[model samples]
Target: MNTIEIKKISKVFGSKTALNNINMSIKQGELFGLIGADGAGKSTLFDILVTLSAATSGSASVHGFDVEKDAKNIRRIVGYMPGRFSLYQDLTVYENLNFFASIFGGTIEDNYHLIKDIYEHIAPFKERPAGKLSGGMKQKLALCCALVHQPKVLFLDEPTTGVDPVSRKEFWGMLKRLQEKGITILVSTPYMDEAVLCERIALIQEGEIMAIDTPVAIIKSFTHPLYSVKSKKLYQLLKDLRNFKETYSCYAFGQTVHLALKNQDTTAIIIQDYLHGLGHENIEIKSIDAGIEDCFMELMKKTAE
Candidate 1:
């Protein structure tokens, strides 16, 4: 069963269009991701789905409850962790968890089984003020509070942002455990690497969904021949490659530049010769598989055209 449904949802604030005709359906127990950079309308869509804000047009529902008409019921079944840290800064970790549980007329003990795995990490620092904890600890506390009511669906807006690498990995591990327990998770992140962790992902750009599919499927859709090129002079290599007549797209990727060609027959030697003629030494070019970022870039470029 689909736990959440959004149809032609659009949100406009004066001249700014925060969301543009968005449509999505998330299945029960599925781990879904909304991948986009900041200001890409991720948070706006989340607010609408969580009933914290209304769409200017179209409609959305959570677990068959209309967002506008059945907000109370939706709120009871959905757990939301906004992009920002929203727990009371002055409250102790234990107190915050207790308070959130009580808001639903329940105590932490009543739903402790739902969040036991996550709560164990913060249990050692239960008396510490929320604001005094580390970034990762704060995140865990917020998640425990969200789950304390035994919510069936979870909405996490950039939950891993600003956290350490170890913490991020541990958090994703926690999410995997939650999914195993049958919680439908819809998480948004600006990090492309994290997109692959989701079972399925929707790539959002400028308030519009560019693509929705499994990470591998999306990568498979990128049919262009791609090459990774590196030279002694990295910056100049990027600029020259972008200016090449046969170059379809050229962008810096870490230590190398990813080059897509207008003609699939273009050879590495041809590219290397071109760079060598321009005084680029130690040129290395090789065919490479397209990743999620590559697919996203191609989609954005196509959308622009």
Candidate 2:
């Protein structure tokens, strides 16, 4: 069953359009991701779905409850962790968790099973003020509070953004465990690497969904003959490659420039020779598989055209 459904949703603020005719459906027990850069209307769409804000047009529902008319019911079944750290800074970790559970008319003991795995990490710091904890600790506390009510659906807006690498890995592990317990998760992130972790992802740009598919399917859909090229002068190489007649798209990927060829028959040696002729020393080029970020870039380029 689709735990969440959106139909032609749009949100406008004065002259600017935050969301444009967006439509998406998330299945129960699915770990879905909304992947996009900041200000791509991710937060706006989340706000509308969580009933914190209304869409300018169209409609949305959560667990069969209309966001507008059944907000109270929807709120009861869904847990929302906004992009920002919203727990009371002055409150102790234990206090914040207690408060959220009480607001839902439940106590820590009543739903301890639901949050035990996460709560144990912060249990040692239960008496510490929320603001005094590390970034990762704060995140765990917020997550425990969100789960304390035994919510069926979870909405995490960039939940891993400011945390350390170790914490981020640990957090995703926690999410996997939650999914095992049958909690539907809809997470948004600008990190392309994290997109692959989701069962399915919707790539959104400028308030519009560019593509929605499993990570592997999206990568397989990339039809371009892509090659990664590296040279002594990286910046100049990018500029020269962009101006190359055979280059379909050229963008920097870490230390190498990922160049999509206009022709499938183009060889890596051909690219290396071209760069070498342009006075580029130590030129290296090799064919590479397209990743989620590559697919996203291609989708964005096509959308612009």
Candidate 3:
């Protein structure tokens, strides 16, 4: 069963359109991700679905209840965690968790199993104020509160941003555990590396979804053979490559410039000569697989045209 549905949902703030003709359905027990950069309207969509804001037009529903007509029932069955920490900083960890649980007319012991995995990790910090805990501990506490009432649908906006690498990994691992519990999760993150963790992902840019599919399928759909070029003078190489007449598009990815060409006939030797002609030394170009971020950049180029 689909736990969340967005149909032609459009939201505009003053003169700027935040979301336009966005449509998606999230299945029960599925981990769906909204992938986008900043200002891509991820948070705006979250607010609409969570009933914090109303869409200018169109509609959305959670667990088959209309967001506009049955907001009270919808909110009861949904748990929302905003991108920023919204917990009371002065409250101790246990206090914050229990307080949220009580707000939903439930006790911690009533839904302990639902949050046991995440709560156990922070139980030792139960006495510490939320502001004093580590980033990961704070994250667990936020999740525990969100799940305290055992909502059928969960909406998380950038839940792992600003955390350390290990903590980010742990956060995603926790999400995987949540998915197994029959809860539908709609999460948005600016981190491309996390896209692969979702069952399906929607790549959004400027309020438009450019692509929607599994991570492997999206990466595989990337056409045009790509080449990664590296050199000691990385910046110079990037500048010279974009100047090449045959270069279709080129963007810096890590230490290399991922380049797509207009003519597949251009040999590596010709590319070498052109770089040498431009006085670039130690240039290296090799055919390699495209990553999720690479595919995202390519899709953005397609959308621009």
Candidate 4:
């Protein structure tokens, strides 16, 4: 069943449109991702679905309960962990978890099994004030508190935004475990790599979903040939490639520039030779597989067109 549904949903803040006719559905036990950069309206959509805010128009529901009409009931079954750290900083780790549990009529012991794996990582610092904890540790504690009540649906907005790579990987592992327990998760992240980890992702930009599909399917839809070109003069190469008539698009990707050619007639060797003529040494250009980020960039380009 669709655990969450949105149709023609739009949110406006006076002159700005936060969400424009957004539509998507998430199935039960699905780890769905809302991929977008900051100010892309991911947080706004989360607020509406969790009953924290009202939409300007259209409709949304969680578990078949209307977000506007049955907001109170929806709140009871959903756990929201906002992008910003909202836990009580002055309180100890143990106190914060217990406090949230009390609100849901649950004790730490009652839901220990649900969050034990995550809580154990933070238990060593249980007596530490939340404000004193490291970014990773605080993230663990916040997640534990969110799961304390065993809510059926969990909303995590950029949960790993400031977290370290190791902690981010560990957190995704914890999420996989939760999905195994049948908890529906709607997570938002700006990291394109993280979007690939979700079963399905909805790429949003400026409050609009550009594409919705599995990461693999999205990548497969990329029809253009992509190449990774690098040389000693990287910046100059980037500028030169952008001005090249045959270059469809050129953007930096790590140490190299990902260039999409306008047509297949010009080969990589031709581009490399052209750069070589421009006094660029150690030039390297070759076709590379497209990833989720590549697909996102392609979609964004199309949207701009």
Error of 4 at 43 (Å): 0.2
- Could you give candidate 4's per-residue lDDT for residues 208-289 as a string of tens digits? 9999999889898987889999999889999999988899898999899999988889898889778888899998878998
- Where does candidate 2 have its weakest 10-residue lDDT segment? 264-273
RMSD of each: 1.0, 1.2, 1.5, 1.0
Which ten-residue region of model 4 has the weakest summed lDDT? Answer: 268-277
Query: How does candidate 2 fare on TM-score?
Result: 0.97
True-structure Cα RMSD, model 3: 1.5
lDDT of each: 0.94, 0.93, 0.91, 0.93
In candidate 2, the residue pairs with backbone N, CA or C atoms under 3 Å apart (3 or more residues apart, or in different chains) clash, namely none
How would you encode candidate 3's per-residue C-alpha lDDT over 1-305 as one tens digit per residue?
47888999999989999899999988888899999999999999999999999999999888899999999998899988998899999999999988999999999999999999888899988999999988778888999999999999999999998899898998899899988988889999999999999999999999999989999999999887788988889899989999999898899988989988777797778888999898887889898788889889989998888
Instruction: Give residue 102's error in model 4 in angstroms.
Output: 1.1
| TM-scores vs. true structure, each candidate | 0.98, 0.97, 0.95, 0.98
Write one digit per residue (lDDT tens) for candidate 1, span 78-187.
99999999999999999999999999989999989889999899899999999999999999999998899989999999999988788999999999999999999999
| lDDT against true structure, model 1 | 0.94
Q: Is candidate 1 or candidate 3 better by lDDT?
A: 1
Angstrom error at residue 1, model 2: 3.5
Q: Per-residue CA lDDT of candidate 2, range 1-305, in tens?
A: 58999999999999999899999999999999999999999999999999999999999999999999999999999999999999999999989998999999999999898789998998999999999998899889889988999999999999999777888999999999999999999999999999999999999999999999899999999989999999999999999999888999999999999999998878887787888889999888888999999999999999999
